[model samples]
Target: MPTDIAFLAIAEAQQLYHWLPAALELARRPGVRVSVLSPSDQLLALVASYDPQGILRPVRLRRPPSRPDSLFRQPSRLATLLLNYATIARFPTLVTTEISSAWLRRVPGFTSHLILIKHGAGDREGGYKKRHADFDLTLVAGEKDRRRMIDRGLCTPEAIAVGGYAKFELKAPRQRYFYNDDPVLLYNPHFDPALSSWVNHGPAILASLESLTGWNVIIAPHTKLARAAAPIVSHAPHIRVDMGSRHSIDMSYTMSADVYLGDVSSQVYEFLLHPRPCIFLNLDHRDGAGDAFAHWRLGQVIDSADALPQALARATGLQPGFVAAQEAAMQESINLSLVPASQRQADLILNFAQTSHPAKS
Candidate 1:
């Protein structure tokens, strides 16, 4: 009999990309049926785009009719899981990118083995929740997360696997966003109010970028943050502000930009895939001494928006000084291997599904 495995996409659309590659890889194999389940039509469409041959099944999960529509307008992560409980419970094994889904294990009749594929490689405390211990298996990008989770008692070494960064397996066609050849700088800020530089210094940073003469700027904040705020507009010809578009999530900005400017976004590690110039914002006065801020060691960390111009000007010249550290950090954050990460992740998931028992409520 074929094993029934479903990839649950209850989080943001950005996370779906991280799981799709593995789902497609698993679907291609015999004796395992992979299905991509989502509440959003946009997400299902994205899966269709990737699976042109219709290999992986697409299942659209619906909100319960008894639930009030207003309450579900912007459903909480837990609510989304609860509302779709009946449909989700049918699968013998379910894979999700967010830890919030672990709550499902407590629901009556929800006996599916819950597997977590961590969505991001950032070192924020929010990423390592106590709920992680509830999952039957967890997959991480590299040694950094594996060590952190074990040390924090979030997951046992046997329950977690360092399957590398599956998101890197996704390939997006490169497109030029700026007309001029002037070096492009991507300013990507995290959404967390306490840790994000944009919460306090966003306008000033944009204002400072306007005065820059030789560089092009792309103001693309984290997708969650952009969705919450009103649409952002850029009047200057040299500056473009993208408030959550497909380009923002598809690695277009990261692959195209020559320099990176950000707060605590994991996208910086993606930008580091090429080892370019990077500048970190420490406007929140975060202590730069811990493992959480380990990425800060890769570039110059500026405390104020006033230092923007000078930092950009010095980034290229200072890049050589940081290249070795950046390379080492990238290796530690994402374990690149001869075998594709998607294949490794698929193998892990398949093995877990065949061997692991259903999670207890």
Candidate 2:
């Protein structure tokens, strides 16, 4: 029988975009029955468009549009687990891009090989956790993660492979929030309270930008940010506060924006794709040295909310001096080579899966 592999998109349905490229490529190969499964009709439809002839499984959950962050994912997980036995028996290699995939290891009658292709490539410490190293195989973004994981004794060198960001290969049109020719700015804040500026400086920063007539601000925060507490609403003509819009999940806001205003989100790297002006909010006073906060060194870093206006003004020029840093940071985050990263990742998984047998739990 052909080796059966399944790509699960339960954690973050929108994040399903990250795995589609590789999954589509895998489905085209011989002796592989690739399954693209998700609880979201929207994501499943998008996945089907990429591989119309392949299998598309939409596992209905108790929660509509079920995602790891959905208001009620516990019922979804419980229901999903109840249906996992048959799935594991057929598809022994289960691939996922979320850390929560580790939960599947405990599923009854499941001895599948769990593979992880992480969602983002950020320099933040939260990205490197002990839970991530549990997967049988991890498809990392680049050298930064691979080196750090091995050094931390969290991941074995043989168990890891560098499979650039496949989502970057997928097509997503840039979205424009404003009609006129105002320069766009993205104020993306991370969800971590200790590290995020959203609590102490996000509102103040928005208030400052409201008076600026030239720049249009998109205050899109990490999706989980609003879940933990009350949503921050914006009422400024020059600003658009998006908690978790399609524009936020896709690279729309990042591509459309001219200047990047962020603290520790990996989306900053996506914005750096075009090498625009960047202003980072350093509310926690993180060290710019070493890999812990290596991303902060890419652009102008401001510690106080009061400095945002001046920094944004100066950063609009994007200073010619920051070009080298932007290029360097972009390199560390992704392997933007001429070759198609999706096909490379698919081939790697195909080769590995063909050789290994399913584990018996």
**Top model number, TM-score:** 1
Tens digits of per-residue lDDT, candidate 1, 1-361, equal 9999999977777887788889999999999998887776667787788889999888877743432322112346677788788888889999999888888878777788999998888877878888999998999998989999999998989999988887777756556878879989899988888788887877887788888899889999998778666666779999999887678888989988999999889999999888999999987677888776889999999988889899988988999999999999888888888899999999999999998865766
- C-alpha lDDT of residue 342 in model 1: 96
TM-score of each: 0.95, 0.89
lDDT of 2: 0.74
The ten-residue window of minimal lDDT in model 1 covers 65-74
- Residues forming the 10-long window of minimal summed lDDT in candidate 2: 66-75
Per-residue lDDT of model 2, residues 331-357, tens digit only:
877878677778878877887787766
How high is the CA lDDT of each candidate model? 0.85, 0.74
Candidate No. with top lDDT: 1
TM-score of candidate 1 against the unseen true structure = 0.95
Off by over 4 Å in 2: 49-79, 107-109, 316-318, 357-361
